[model samples]
Target chain A: MTIRKIDIFRTGLRTFFIQSLWNYESLLAYGIAFSILPILIKLYSKRDIIRKGREYLSYFNSQPYLAAFILGMLIKLEEDAVENSINNNSKISSVKASYMGPLAAMGDSFFWWCLKPATLIITIFLVMYFNDFSNALFLLSFFLIFFNAFHLYYRFGSISFGYKYGEDGLKFFQKFNMNLFQKVMFQITFFLLGISITMLVLKFPFPKLVENIEIFKHIEFQIFYGISVIFLFFIYKLKRSPLLLILTTLIIIFIFSFLKEKNLVFLRIN
Target chain B: MIFKVLLAGLISGLFQLDQTGAFQFMLSRSIISSTILGWVLGSIIGQPELGLRYGFLFGIFFDLIWLFRLPIGASTPPDYQIGSSVAISSLILGISFFNPKFIYIYVFICLVMGFVSGYIGAWFDVIIRRLNINISRMSRYYWNKGKFLKFKSLMLLGLFNSFVKAFLITIVFLFLILILNPILNFIFENIPGFIVEGFAIVIFFIPALGLIVVINHIIKESTWKVLGLGIVTGAIIFSYLKDFHVFGFLIILFFCIIIWVNVLKKEKV
Candidate 1:
């Protein structure tokens, strides 16, 4: 029997909640199982239902956006199993394992690394600089909308393409260039940070730094660029998490205040 | 006491812990959680305005710091909810009203606690995942027995366990703060006044760390020259138009965009 549009749509919806049962043992294997449960139930007899469910319980993992590919392939494979057309159940696992790593890497780079950082930087900048809650909210709302919208598109795109290509959808993904998009974003993020660092330094009114405004004026732009260079080199060598690095800076300040100054207590600022 | 603990538990569990039922739509975020606690605590203390003000600031500030982390698969990001919750609760407790200046120390202490809690939260997830995997096993068992209801409930147990774990962690942390307040205050009081003044300075620089992460992620040795040249040109344009700051920034921004367009378009060609 052919898979219905309703089944395909329902399977797509199921992809959202697959992580509800996410466990370390099988990673997202259970979520994958749950997503395909409807298809398995419809295609298999009651006796074969448990067997099919157990099949998905094997070690399976991937980032959520690309999960549509796996779900699409599962639907096609289940249909074949139902018809007694293929006995090689290992084919499903092999295809899943093969495609899982690359898709996950792509998802991580695109969604987590590039898109999230950019959205967050914009939202944070709005909140910090403008001091306007509504502005940040507006940007965040637009970001959330755009982020989820693309994922939904990927869902539909992955399923349709996965169904059309069957196992070779893996090959289809290879033909698609995630790197070109990544490179463009990489440049944008780099450029934005340079601008943000300059703005941050210029706007901040440091008492000591302000006293030397005449001097800072001459080298103010250079100082901004200098900090950017220092920061880049520091991170390059340290390879420490950014938060941890900031925490260390905080620690250094705390210690410096006590050690460098005559005493722990100093004159209070208004 | 129970009410506050329960409230923290409910919000944290709903937002960060469970991450299901679409409830996370508003709860999991630092902004919402901090504002909720700030607003609620203010009402309890009859200082709603101040509570709301600090709550939003803290939320936004931490959200900036939390930007770099993205929870992918088994690699959970650090928990901002823990930090926000701890910060709000402690700030609302009474320190802000005391000297106002003393809140700086509390901010430092609470944030440190929050960071530790976040790591613990990640560890707790590992434990929760282990427990949930057993539910999957149990569901498989029930499925074998043809007990479909049992299978369904067993599957749902995983979701329930996440809530329970989140709820417990929040409650315990709340109480831990209450129990440890004396010790925390002692440490706070002992901290040097110079350090206290320096903290405000440190907070401003913290965002620099975030910018570094973004740039570090993007930098490739191959593109360094172009990246350097583009920014230097933008800054030169800004320096030339220094009188009107806004115009200078915009012109620089426009210059960057033009360069970006040219660069990308050239790549296309």
Candidate 2:
């Protein structure tokens, strides 16, 4: 008997909720088991159902998006088991173990670290660039669509492709070179950050730096840029939380600006 | 106000679920979550643009602050979704009653509140995860007993728990904000102009902090060459073109896309 496309689609949909039961002990174990239950019920006899389902109850975790690939592979294995009357439980578990860690790592670096922040910086630049708030909303939608398109591709692709390729699906992912993708994304993010910072400085020049509007006009950019770098260094090197640094800076700025407003003798602002 | 609070709570519940429960769609992201919160609250009060602006601002700000933190495993990052919800809802609700001239004060306070609320929300998140262990166990027990219905219910129960947790938190935070709104208004109104101006300054510089935070994440010795080249190119372009320079923006954006396509082409090769 062939596993229908609708069954795969159903499994794909279920994969979205696979992490719904995420807990400290078994992590994604229950969710994973739940996701494959429908497929298991359809494929296995009642007597073998419990035994087959028990395999997924063990601790299992993976990047949520990549879980689809693992599930697809599991379904394919289950299908083969049903066809050949062979228990592939051990193979399924091993396959899951093999893919979960690496996929999680790649997904974290690529999806979370690279794709997300890269798109975010671009969206932010657009948001800041466009004065119209509706345009900002449009950009936000673009950010969502752009990010999720890759996500759903991996998800839908993983399920279908993993089923098609079975264990060899790993080779398909190997072709992508996620590290290079991450590097390129980081480069784009860095480039966009540079533009974003320049635009930010242009938008909100330091009040003190802009004190002399005529003479210090061009110099303000350089000074603000230097200040941003210094802040970046402190953020990078500081052992404490960056949130602390931000709060402290806010306090200091509050004091300075307040004193300047009050026209204090020593720390007075023109 | 009741309608707005209820709506905020509902979406906050869904967004919270989006973060960890049903769908990991980027809906829970600060950029989207906060904007949705802002838009909803803004529309309720007949101020869609105001909602979008502040929502977008808060989303961008919070997203930058927490951009580098990844949920690689069981680790929970600060819950920016709830934070933005509380913050944006409070701002929109607060602005509804207060003088618009004093909007800067509201933005400043709400931002700080949002930042603080994220940590609070995360604290709750850790507790929720801990509590979910019982649900997981029960679901397993039911599954083992061949009570698939009970097992499914337990699965949904976990999601429901997450939703209720988020909804209650949002409602509670918004309630506190509503109660304190008048007091906050009076206090800020009585405060001298200089202090308010200082907060305005802080708000202006806040984006710089966010920009630097993100830049720091990408800045490394290995990537500095590309980064430096980008900075130079960006600097030249920004210096020449002024605000809303769509033409110049498009050119640089186009160049970035070309490089991206080139990289993909190389990958295909």
Candidate 3:
């Protein structure tokens, strides 16, 4: 029996909960079953549904957004199982096991590492440039829409494509070349970040003495700020905790401010 | 005041549902959620501008600070939502309740508290995940007994648990803020002006650290040359162009170049 449009829609909607029941033992196994239940219910009787659901109870995990594609392919496989009695559980298990790691890597790199940061850098740029509340709000709305639009398109498209093309739907991932996309995103983000850093440094309230020094006047502050960022980046590369860095900075600032208050020699900035 | 606290709790609960329960539409993100919370608080107090300022300040800090912490797979990073929500709520509520003159002190204290609360929230998140082991087991039990409805209900139960966790954390923090307001007010009165100024300075510098983190993430071996070009471009824009109109056009031009490059790449492919 062909899965109806409404059932497909229902399955797509249920994919949202794929992480709702995430746990240690099964790690989205139940969620996978839960997401595909709409299709399973439409295709099987009560006994068959339980058996099919039981098949998914073993450990399974992947990037949450890409899980829909796997679910759709799984439904197609299940349909084939019902019609043609293809080799049952092992095939599904292997397909899932093989796909989850690569898809997780792709989703994490593309969505989490690349896109989120790019949008954020852009948001910071716009907000800093505009420096207005309403504009900030409008920019924030842009962030949400820009992000979710791409998210929803892939989310729904993956489901439909996987269902339609079965395993061959993976060509979508191959065709996109996520690594190139990531490299491109890095370029854009780095450019924006450069601007943002400069803006942030220019806006910083330097001490009058520091600001007045002829040699330190024009862009010395920006240079110092850039060097500090590189220093901090190295500390981060050393796997030092951000909390530790913040605490150290705070302590140093607190000491300097205190000494300056005490009329320390040549250190007054406020 | 009680109504505001309750409303904040409700908002926190609903916004956090987007964390894992539903769409993952990034409503749970600190910047957006804090802004929305700030807007709501502003509306409640009849000073929308002040609220937005508070929200924007705290939101940017949290967003930038936690930008590098990716929640990939099973790795549960610090739950920044609680930290940001708690910080913003405390700041707004402290201002409303105590009417402290040294607002920076309040903001500073609230930020530290919020940062601590984030680690606490993540600890609780681990607990909740562990407890969900029992939940999945119960689900299996029901599935074995042919109780599909009950099995589905477990997922809703999981969602509800998440909502309740966020709500309870916010409510508890609100109460803590209420109890500590007098102490904080007293300290605010007694604190040295320089110390407060130092905190304000530190607060301003925190974002620089966050920027460092983002820069570290993006500036791989392949991208540094592009980043160098960007810095040069930014320096030119900041120094040469005083008019926003020119700046706006340049910004648009940059986006056009990005799009053009993408199109060129696609066509070549």
Model 2 segments more than 4 A misplaced? A175-177, A204-229, A232-236, A259-270, B97-101, B257-269
Task: Return the TM-score for chain B, candidate 1.
Answer: 0.72
Which stretches of candidate 1 lie above 4 Å from their native place? A83-88, A168-177, A204-236, A239-247, A255-270, B1-5, B17-77, B92-98, B190-194, B222-256
Ranked candidates, highest lDDT first: 2, 3, 1
Tell me the tens digit of each residue's lDDT in model 2 across B1-269. 78878988999898988887887878888889988788888888898877877787778778887877766577878777887888898888877677765666777778878887788887777787888898888877777777777887888888987898779888888888889988988997897776665554444456666776776666688666666666676677767775547787787778788767866787789
lDDT value for model 3: 0.74
lDDT at A122, model 1: 50
Q: At residue B34, what lDDT does model 2 achieve?
A: 88
TM-score of each: 0.80, 0.90, 0.90
DockQ order, best first, reads 2, 3, 1
RMSD of 1: 5.3
Model 2, span A1-270: residue lDDT tens: 779999999989988888787878888888888888888888876667777666888889888888888999998999998899887878987998898998888777778878888888878877766656657667788888989898888888888989988978877677667777776687677777776666655543323212233322344334633574466457545743657656765665566566666666654334
How high is the TM-score of chain A in each model?
0.76, 0.85, 0.84
Pairs that clash in candidate 1? none
| A195-270: candidate 3 lDDT, tens digit per residue | 6676666543122212133323335334544565666668776774768666665665576458657755444343
DockQ of 2: 0.52
All candidates' lDDT scores? 0.63, 0.76, 0.74
Candidate 2 chain A lDDT trough over 10 residues, lowest sum:
A207-216
